[model samples]
Target: MAKFKIDINANKHFTGELSPVFSVAEARKASQFHKGLQGYEPTPLRDLSSLAEMMGVKGILVKDESYRFGLNAFKMLGGVYAIARLLCEEFGWGIEQFDFDKLKNEVDEKMTFATTTDGNHGRGVAWAAEQLGQNAIVYMPKGAAEQRVKNIRSHGAECIVTDMNYDDTVRMVAEKAQQNDWKIVQDTAWEGYTDIPTWIMQGYSTMAVEAIEQIAEQGLPKPTHVVLQAGVGAMAAGVLGYLAEELGASDLKAIIVEPDQADCIYRSGSSEKGEMINVGGDMATIAVGLACGEPNPLSWDVLRNCSSHFVSVEDKVPALGMRVLGNPLAGDERIVSGESGAIGTGLLAAVHFSDNKAELMQSLNLNEDSVVLLLSTEGETDPVNYRDVVWQGKYSSI
Candidate 1:
């Protein structure tokens, strides 16, 4: 197994300051927008008490995004909501006044939505475009699985496999969108491109809102710690923003997990404020969805303050988590988590099982009384890889 690395944020402080950009109220509004869409239902928040016991934690709650909008991933929430907001703005109609059917009928065929992704996010963009009756152009990074490219195309969007890494592909698409006048509905934000990505982050708050309500309905105490996996940190920011609102920042421990090879967030957290660091190279990780080389600028603000700890694990870590979730200890419900989805749980397992367990556990304040929450962000986005890892016990050679 590959060794894990942890970085305690130097500037980590729980200010209890509500984020103006992403708040519980904003998330609630985003959730309302999602409710108007077809196939809108809250995904399950599973109680993995047995797994908690195994890890010696008080409780372990997992919000499974496998069932989200039939896409087997959570990106649809962001993609669709951003598309809606973009349409509303373009048509000069308020969200409440905008009609989907009317927009679909009148939407200009020349208007196209475009984005870049490793897999799930591209499919989400394509799905959103199909729903809105708009054309979509999706670009995927080199070495992206064929199944993922096909999934994007299945949504009636034009899918292109590019000979570039994730970040480069994103830049390429952005430039092309600007040149061709296609609307860019990306989830990651840069300078002067914050508005739509902010909307995307707000949309992701729906998952957090649903999880909090589900926990309350089940009479479970609010999670003492939340472990979120990051690509560009959009989902992490949204979850942290909502949780910081509900459970004060000081009361909750927020951990950001990423692939060691693609540890941009970890590097960013360790750097000086406003300093951008790139975790360069191919970012070859089994968890393709979290293989981002850079942190989203907008998300960095929330993550830098709200996140207490950052952990970067090797590909073996999430592979182990996929196996553990797929074939849980007796009495534990099975969770079909894809490579990206299982990293949070994998990080927890690594800490508990490592030789430096005592020190690492103490650093994160993980104890028997700790209530941990995790978001399983995708489910078998690449089935061939999933089967090899889960059934054959093969570690990704990538």
Candidate 2:
């Protein structure tokens, strides 16, 4: 039994007005900015028809971000774009006037870019810094996988494994960056630190743009429900922003999923005015990437207004999702999704297969006619752990 907590956002008051924080035009601009980068390409959108039938949905479309920029994660779209924008500002050049070679040559050696991550985000930051010819310092939470640390270091970043939880590490890195005058390219936002994080969120909108375009090209109908995995709600807000613009807020259901151990978004959505809430302590979940204790305030506004539901699932849920994707039944194609990447599918499975199916399905308004979209945000970023979970069926040990 996968333990889960779900909340229907009673404070979700969408007056049919789009989010003011991000727009479709900004998302398109971000996509254009990404296209100017070296390895810019749209990741594959796979149709998991077999899985959809098994889950009793009309269809399931998954945006496989495992192939994104060889980073095995969608975070590069955000990190790289944020880095470029920061460099453009620092060099006093317009976006089109920006030249990577010139910036690389003129960049100060003492200037170091920094961020805190569970894994993929730090790798994206390190990879972006390497591409831009700048130094990067990445901080990871205490229990971060060794393979992830090595991946970050492979991009020539100074990787530090901090003896803190994910949220504490983020706070530590932010404070140290401020004290040392290093530029912090974080995905999460708080007061007075909203610009870069907003840029990061805007950059993430590129993925949604690509997915929407791909769905159109394939002649498929717009998805009725979008299940997004949330860590501070940046990616979810980005996707929701674009979709809410293209398809009105009432046309689709936007669901946010997070680790039960780090249910900040769930708590916030359940609050009186969707107020920001903090979950303090060591959040131990196999879905390490979503192990954030606090919701990003900038993203909170977008999510509270546009998103319909917030879900928090136990660790076993994602493990089971990984297994399901890895061992596809019959005609279903195999998908290599990591712990964090598979949570959306996991949440779907938990709700659909659990004993409380009727209540859960009715809450999300899911039915056989509903078309569902899931974002598999990463591949097997950690191979050893992936092997254990998928092949060995070792959910508890993880």
Candidate 3:
């Protein structure tokens, strides 16, 4: 088994200030726009009380994203919101003037939206393009799950399976988008590509907005800590950025987790907490969505500024987490968390049940008085692999 690893970020840049892109204001703005979308309902925020009890925490809250816009994933929030914002800017239509139907009517010619994804983000881009009466072409990294590709194609978008790894595939799509005059709605930002990705990051903060509101509804205290799973750190930036802005950065602790093979964020933070470092090659892990080798430069800044610690774990760890959520303990709601979605939970479970619980607990500042929030970002995006892990016991903890 690959050993679990942790990195504490030195020289954090959080000074109770919010970046313009992933700020709380942007999240609320995105949330308002999202509310105007058809079939928009906030996904359930489930309290894993039994699991919290088992782990000796005061409260454990999980935002279940499987039901998001009926997409079985939360990525569409970023994808759709970014598209809407892009269109609004392109046509001088205000956000209030940018409802789906109204925007579809305003489109004179079909714009092609293009992006690369391991799975969820591509589907989101494709779905948004389809909804806007435009065209979409999604590119996937080598050996991406067929199910994820199929999901994107179902949105009437062209799906391209590349022979390259994720980061390289991203470059491929960038070239393709430029060649075809397509709008690249990539969630990760590189140089000269900050605005759209920034909007996408803001879109993700909708979950954080709802989670905080839901916590208040339940009369639970604000989350003392947040456990975020990173893939290019887009989702991590969105959620953490908003949280740090809402709750004082110094008040909330952030933990970032990733598959050991693709833990670019972890590696970047660990190396004297310097410039963003990247891992390359096929990150052959079951958590395919989290198999991104490059840290998004936009989110890398947010993560380095806000995150307290980074943890990297083996594939078996999230498989263990899938089992834990799949098989509910007592009255806790069974959340069919996919490999990428459940890694945070898996890491928690591994630490709680391990011989190093004391050390791990202290390192994470996880204690009986702490209220923790975890994001189950996607459901079974690839049902076959999910069944293999949860049913066939592939990558079992034993």
Candidate 4:
């Protein structure tokens, strides 16, 4: 059996239905806002040229988001922006008129922000709330890492662990938030709740803005392809939306990847109707960040129209990616990518080394001239798990 499930999005095309929020112009505004934060720096976009040559691609650029806000992940970009936007709305102030310091000084009421997360997003929300002397309540699904819970609580948030899985916990948190009037900073959008998620997605577009700008500065050609990993499609959609608007969809071939266990976006894209798909149960997977089963309805629209292909791969794929990045080729910078962070690299490596590279390469439109872009969305958030994969070779297919 194939270790991968490659699905062509028959509905994929340039629909020109780009949301105003993801316009490159708007994303630049968000990036400017993030720059106004206390400690803001654009993460490094590494040129994995040697790896690209081995894979028979012209060039490969991986945006290492491990350095984002000292958080070891890119989740905070969304959390901080959504939280800031919430405060701006509540105070009747324009975002452009206030910097981080001004916003912090102006907050009179201590507001509570609530959200459900696996690990990264909760810590992000808690960090954002703590920065402005506000409160946060973070709900985590069952089997959430204790280290993750402690990380959130370290930021002064009340971290709650529940017996439910990620998606179920989201529903439960929504009920409690309604009862307590807590502002939900979730990335997944649903009926009657979209503005915060929209803000979060827009915040995520800063990555796209930075990556494209960095490519130009490095004298590299624009990326012909992007390999994005998705959970609820928030991060993937957010980045892809901005790229499509800025680069023009005609030139970029986008691919969305997810773990086989919880590939909601892949399933939805492959489905005939291309509607929202939900996967329920204990979403057991080593790539915990990509184990989400519910597709964000808002992001689903963008992926359906803006992306070229979707692939769901085994845990071994990400395992290989982690090892390759940790042990880089000569003259290339080493990256300590976590399980969720390294999958894009892993998927590319798999396609290169697979026995049927011809078929797989043709399917993905990857070749000697393809300029690929990958986002290493995190670093070693879970040291134990990272060691298990990289040191022990726990899921190495070989």
For all predicted structures, in order, the TM-scores are: 0.95, 0.95, 0.96, 0.96
Poorly placed runs, candidate 1 (over 4 Å)? 1-16, 108-110, 272-274, 396-398
Residue 157 error for model 1, in Å? 0.6
The lowest-lDDT stretch of 10 consecutive residues in candidate 1 is 5-14
Worst ten-residue run, lDDT, model 4? 1-10
Summarize candidate 3's per-residue lDDT along 98-179 as a digit string, tens digits: 7777767766888889999999999999999988898999999889888998999999999989899999999988998888
Model 1, CA-based lDDT: 0.86
lDDT per model vs. reference: 0.86, 0.86, 0.87, 0.88
lDDT of 4 at 336: 95
Per-candidate clashes, comma-separated: 0, 0, 0, 0
Q: Model 4: residues >4 Å from true position, as ranges? A: 1-16
TM-score of 4: 0.96
The 10 consecutive residues of candidate 2 with the worst lDDT sum are: 2-11
Quote model 2's TM-score. Answer: 0.95
